[model samples]
Target: MNTLAHGFADGPGPGPWILFVPLMWALVVGGGLFLLRRAGWRGRAPWQQGRAALGEQSPIVVLGRRFAAGEID
Candidate 1:
């Protein structure tokens, strides 16, 4: 019987490819998290920032703009 017919009979066990799967998964998850964070998924989004900036305006300023735009009397 040829020992080579059976894998790892006398040769080295597994190669570095054994760790590639988990490493790829870790990279995929980590990259996704990084993208989410960069896209402001964890904090205020761009639209929210615009709203916050508008909100920061003084009430009188908002009223003046509304009156100028004829939104209110």
Candidate 2:
């Protein structure tokens, strides 16, 4: 019976380098997401910046704008 055929081989199965492939992919995807979010945040118009920073406006403020625009009686 041949030793190689009988499952007596002596060599490294996968080695530590195989782990780097998924790690590199995760870093690349995470970095791309971070850059996209940063770009989107910076791309907002100047007028929109204050509203975004302040979160949702109050209902009274919304009514005031509508009244000022003559959209409300």
Candidate 3:
């Protein structure tokens, strides 16, 4: 009975080795980041300061609309 069932079914396939694909990728990415950090690579370029300063009002279009709607301080 068991021997007949084995003939008609798929065998247990590719065990845990398939998991190594993502594992290797994770290690590679982690290693690259580690090397970059050791080599003084700070990830992204610093953002340039924008022309707008803190505590500034919105553009004239927005201010005009707000004043017309009585929504401004």
Best by lDDT: 1
lDDT of 1 at 13: 49
Model 3, range 1-73, lDDT digits (tens) per residue?
3443243345644555566778999999999999988977776553323325522444765788788899996
**Stronger candidate by TM-score (2 vs 3):** 3
- Winner by TM-score between candidate 2 and candidate 1: 1
lDDT of 1: 0.72
Candidates' lDDT values, in order? 0.72, 0.70, 0.65
Q: Could you tell me which residue pairs clash in candidate 1?
A: none
Report the C-alpha displacement of residue 43, candidate 2, in angstroms: 13
Q: Which stretches of candidate 2 lie over 4 Å from their true place?
A: 1-10, 41-73
Please write out the lDDT profile of model 2 over residues 1-73, one tens digit for every residue: 3333333345545455567779999999999989978877676676766765555475668888899999999
Q: lDDT, candidate 2, residue 18? A: 65
Listed per model in order, the count of residue pairs whose N, CA or C atoms clash below 3 Å is: 0, 0, 0
> Which of the two candidates, 2 or 3, achieves a greater lDDT against the reference?
2
Itemize residue pairs with steric clashes in candidate 3: none
Off by over 4 Å in 3: 1-10, 44-73
| TM-score order of candidates, top first | 1, 3, 2
In candidate 3, position 36 carries an lDDT of 89
Total clashing pairs in model 3: 0
Q: Report the error of model 2 at residue 5, Å.
A: 22
